[model samples]
Target: MNNPAPASPSPASEYGARARAWDWRRALAPTGNVGDAVFRAALFGCALLLLLIVVAMFVEIGSNARLSISRFGLPFLAGREWNPVRGEFGALPFVYGTVVSSLLALALAVPVSLGIAVFLVEQAPRALARLLAFLVELLAAIPSVVYGLWGIFVLAPFLREHVEPPLQKALGWLPFFQGTVTGIGLLTGGVILAIMVTPIVTAVVRDVLAAVPVSQREAALALGATKWETTRVVLANGAPGIAGAIILGLGRAVGETMAVTMVIGNRPEISASLFQPSYTIASVIANEFTEATGDLYLSALVELGLVLFLVTFVVNGAARLLVWSVTRGTSGVARA
Candidate 1:
């Protein structure tokens, strides 16, 4: 057969040729258009608002830099001294407390939150899941002050009576528990922080776990995987997002004022013992901001606030990046 006559254009192709022949300049406007202007304005407005907020914080805190440097020096971050009466002000103790409590909260909350999320999204009946989720959300809605009161009246005493004594007995060989279980130490504060942040971590984790497509679970089941194996794979795939949830919860823990302040005992000293009471940056501010007598004191507090804000910002930003990486990895998996 003659080299199949160069495949003739179909009728649809002919119609397309005719269509391109017609002028449609009015119908399809040029690139510079109304939509572009509106989009630009909206973006600019958002950027301007964000700039204003950042500028406000900078301006507010900049006024205190001179005092912070003059009084404390660069060594403030490393030195453990924090005597306001003696005019010595090192942030080391507060930094230690803040980090310890936040990390401790993360340690305690992450597993429990993950379990709750996995159970709710994967295992529980629909009505029970909804009820439990509502309860967690309700916990978040509870005011910090309420949590503080509960910590003071209910939780603290229980820890003092039951948890602390046993923990001290068991881990007492460790330096962190070498001292008496005074019921208002780093461990106690951390436990309170864990309780306060549990709802947050659980809620975020629940959402992320739910976002895992059913296909993954079905595929695992098809491969004869056990329920635990399927769940494990889902958790492994969503590890970054779960980590982000923990970090976000930690951000909340670091900034938590009322509950930590109420139970932390606000002692501005560094000790190896977790049972030795300590003060956090947020607790220090909450406890003393009202009565802060001098300019140095007030500025120091403001500077602490700035430090906390920076810390939480970094943590949350890192968490988002981790989640983004997970999403990208998940996309890669889908493509492959």
Candidate 2:
């Protein structure tokens, strides 16, 4: 032992050993920096401010709608007649129109959006994908009023003359297709909404699909999967994100005002035919808010706003949950 003096550990070797034993948990442990604490507090305050703003909006709308809420109670939602002259108001038609139009838009937009997203993410050349993606996003940048104007001038006439007549001849027996083929009606509104929401949905879905790990695609392909099969695997993995995109598009359709108001014919009547004129909650609010002379009329309109607000809130919340669920599930799977 006296004959042997152990050589001092080299600096490089010591550092290498320390690095090998390093724990991420210990590395990330709080150092109690004042700057970090301040930054965290600022972020929390910003988040809280958003919540406060949402709460404030709800409270304000509810207070304004109190008159109609108290007078009509639950029946306001169910009442079919909307007569302001006689002081009779019902939200059923607006609710129906909003639901039907939004759903119709989803039905029309989702397939097309998904196809575009898939092509952009997986099939198209890089240059072509970028061009198409830019064009698609450009659609979203156009003003809503501009869409309304185009709908009124172009889409409405085309549908009324060319599309509706053929559909009526082919599907006349169906209640949805049976009606006067007016360009400015529920169907037109739905088409306009589809166009408006398409860009949003496509962009989101493209991002989501792109976010799928390349290894996942490679793994599927290496396992004898065809290109389409590989694509399907990617789609399955990105399902939650795709769902969130669609829901977000639905929210956009639900809250759209100017364009819907312009094309939806603004009639507060419920007919089985999509060709018939209709009014949505947002459209009705936009149309009548300025014209509401009576307190009850104003309150009824405010209540409609509240209804739209609640619907949008629920849709977005569901989308968030769907996204979160998939994220958590993926993380858990990775850990296992």
lDDT against the true structure, each candidate: 0.80, 0.88
Which pairs, if any, clash in model 2? none
191-256: candidate 2 lDDT, tens digit per residue? 999999999889777877877889999999999999999999999998998898899899999999
**Which regions in candidate 1 have their CA more than 4 angstroms from the true location?**
1-47, 325-336
- RMSD values, in order shown: 8.7, 9.6
At residue 27, give the lDDT of candidate 2. Answer: 41
Best by lDDT: 2
lDDT of 1 by residue, 198-245 (tens): 888887777677668789999999999999999999998788878887
Clashing pairs in 1: none
Q: Per-candidate TM vs. native? A: 0.82, 0.84
